[model samples]
Target: MSGGVDSSVAAFLLAQQDYDLSAVFMRNWDTGDESGTDKGCEWEKDWEDVQRVCKKLDLPCQMIDLSQEYWNRVFEPSLKQWESGVTPNTDVWCNREIKFGALLERLPAPTTSNKKPWIATGHYARKSWSTTPNSPHTRPRPKLLRPSDRGKDQTYYLSSISEEGLSRALFPIGHLQKSEVRELARKHQLHTAERPDSVGICFVGEKAKFSNFLSSYIPPNPGPVVDQVSGKTLMQHAGLWTFTLGENARIPGMKERMFVSSKDQLSNTIYVVPGSDHEDLYSNTLRVSDFTWIWNDAIPPDLSTPQGFRVDLMHRYRMHSVPSTVRKAETGDLIVTADEPEKAVTPGQIAALYDGDWCLGCGVIKSTSR
Candidate 1:
């Protein structure tokens, strides 16, 4: 439950419904804070909060240590992606592997044979249930829907989750806005009612910057920063992994500000452009691999056909979506052609598709055509 207000509220809401429930607090990262005195260190404080809320609600709470699982499953793969100069969505893996996969499996078995135990979370996403299925085995269809709180909707992080895992998932607070969640927390006198929302990566302390945290794991590898247009060496960089596409490039002597346009992982070099509107930073088409269709497990649209299968595409969390068409390429990869060129569509990041309120599918962007 992350010891946050949303999760506390979620538990309270579920408890109010009179369903037998048990709270689980996952310890994904140790944070290496042995002293436990670091003010910004969230592990100890978050655990205490979880205990407080569970005690107040008269619910049994257990701490599951999944630090090694997180390191092997989520962090290691992400480290390799960054080292290879591709930005991976680590949270997506965390939700799919740890939260839904491992934690759900560890839940106590149901008391009755017919009653299936479900795992509840603070994720701001809704599920629409339908008894009529597309086939015999798929009797009930659980469609992932956008929560009432648009800004806080977390379906993007959960795009890679499987149908079986989603079937046993519940998000009690998805119907309520963030403001209403806090209000409900206050009404219930929960300890997390006034706690500030945690920010950045879960392992990184609140006071530490993401760059600083990353530097510890990835040693500095010096490389040249080149201009994409002129092919001229502009400056030297500490590491290729330090920069992200579309972020500012603070060159020492250059008067005009530049943005990160691209990177060459083979040469360990970074490429930059003069401005945000640079031609090198936008893409009209992109190739995606490791695609998953959450709604229907059918073959993707054929690319040879006339621009069929229209869907709204999102490149990142909370980013404005653009109209796009999905088609299967001859190489067995999914190709997405946007109606409008998208800026800084980075490789190794997730690209999600939607139809109205339902999230259709998502894929890992392999490359983009600038």
Candidate 2:
């Protein structure tokens, strides 16, 4: 539980259902002000809130320290992706590697004498079960779908989860809207009933800035910014990792807002162009590699067949899926043609494929073309 109202209510609702439960609070950072004196820092208070909720529910609670693993697996790899001028989804990696992956690893194995353990989180997404078991060893894998609360659904961030993981995961608050969750919390007299939601990174507290958090691990390298239209130098930036496509990076003389169109790490230069809602910034097609399909063995045969099928393609978290026709290229990479052009189809973003509400698979965006 991230010490938020949603998670606290999730635990409460699960307890009402009479399921045996244990609460775990993951401790991911140690550099913050532990005293909670900083203006926005509240790690200590958040922990206290989690503890109080667990106590009220009579559920055993423990704080697990996964700082080393989180840094090694999630943070470091994310930095490397940014250094190469690609925007990596760190939260997705965190959910996959730390929250679900390491947490399951640390739990005691199930045996004939012991009950199997299942994990529950406060993510706003629904899990659907099939009518019959799909395999002998286990039941059918849970299918991920949008929650009843359309505004709060988080299935996009969870597209990378494997079939095995989804089978054991539970989202207790998936069917409830945020308002309903708050009302339930209030009914239970939970302290976080009216608490504001956590912002920025999950583990990091309010005061933590992304740049400050990354600066400690990634050494800053100042680089030059060049105008893509003029072929002229502009200003220096603190580091390439500090910016992303469609971002208006600060420059010296250019008064009009400029957006980063591309970055060249080999030459240590960033390309900028005048910001506008123009067609040039968008593209109709993108190439995706390193594909993984959650539901099928390989990309659907229909995707490659002469008779094409339309699918929903999501390139980033919270962004609406764009309708597209997906086809397999000669080299085996998936080629996606958006019904309408998409803006800033950056390299390194995960391109997830979906059919209706079910996530079929995902792959990394390798390149794009106009």
Candidate 3:
């Protein structure tokens, strides 16, 4: 449940049904064990909130420790990506690896005649089954769709989920707006009716300085900061992980503002351009490694033909999808050509494709070209 209003309201709506319902809270962080003076995520408070909401609804609740799973599946890989100066979306992997990957495996087997229990979450995404005769398999296939509230659509985060994960998942709040969910909680007098929405990364959200949190794990590697326009070294940087592409590069004694243009790991150098809209900061082409289609067997036939299939591409979670074409490279990578140049299309980010409001799937961005 994550002890949030969305999940609380979702459980409340599910309780009105005849199916047996229970809440399982996964504790993915051990805040006290970290060396930082500042204790990390306050998971205990969130757990308490989950307990309070579950008690009022009379739903059985259990907490499971998934710190090891999170570290092995999501955090470790993300750490390596960040260390290499790439912005990997750990939140997206959390859904695919933890929520759907590990959690799905931990669910108990069905006992009664009515087996096959569906897992429900508060994610603002909708799903529907394909009823057409040309469906992938004889059985209907599940399609991940954007929620009713377009502003709150979360299909981007869920674009990497497997077919099985989407099929077994149910989202009660997909059709409800954020305000509507809070109102439903208030109308039912739920304990978490007034609780504020969560912000930032999952477990590390409470950390004041993200660099401080990361420093606790990765050691410092001093690097040279350089100017992109002129081949001149600016100054020494603490670490490449401190800055992100397209973010302000506050170098001392610079006449004008600077923004990150690129990072060269081979030379351990960070490159900065004069302004935010510098041509060096934009890219119209991206090479994605190992693109995964949700319906693997039902891949659009046109994608394999002479003319590449057109799809909307989105690398960041909140950003709108851009018109793009995808074609299979001889080396097995997927080449994405955007109709418009995209800024901050950083490496290690997952690029998701969509056909209208339905998310096709995603792949890790290998590299970019202007």
Best candidate, TM-score: 3
**C-alpha lDDT of all candidate models, in order:** 0.84, 0.79, 0.87
For candidate 2, lDDT tens digit of each residue in 1-370? 8799988988998888866678988876654434444445455677888999999999888888787888888877888987777878877777778887887778765454475578889999888976323334354456788888878768877888777777788999998999999999898799899999777776454533776666666788888898888888888877787777767766667767778887888887888888765454688798998777765443466777875668998887777888998998899898988898888888888898788887767788988887
* Candidate whose lDDT is highest: 3
> How good is model 1 by TM-score?
0.93
Per-residue alpha-carbon lDDT of model 3 for 233-320, expressed as tens digits? 9988878888888988888899988899999998889999998899999999999997788887777767766689999999887787
Better of 1 and 2 by lDDT: 1
2 or 3, greater by lDDT: 3
The C-alpha RMSD in Å for every predicted model, in order, reads: 2.4, 3.3, 2.0
TM-score-superior candidate, 2 or 3: 3
Clashing residue pairs found in predicted model 2 = none
| Candidate 1: tens digits of C-alpha lDDT, residues 159-277 | 88888888888989889999999999999899899998877677774534777777878888889999887888988988877889888888878768889998998899999999779
Error of 2 at 79 (Å): 1.8
Arranged by lDDT, best first = 3, 1, 2
Candidate 3: C-alpha RMSD to true structure equals 2.0
Clashing pairs in 1: none
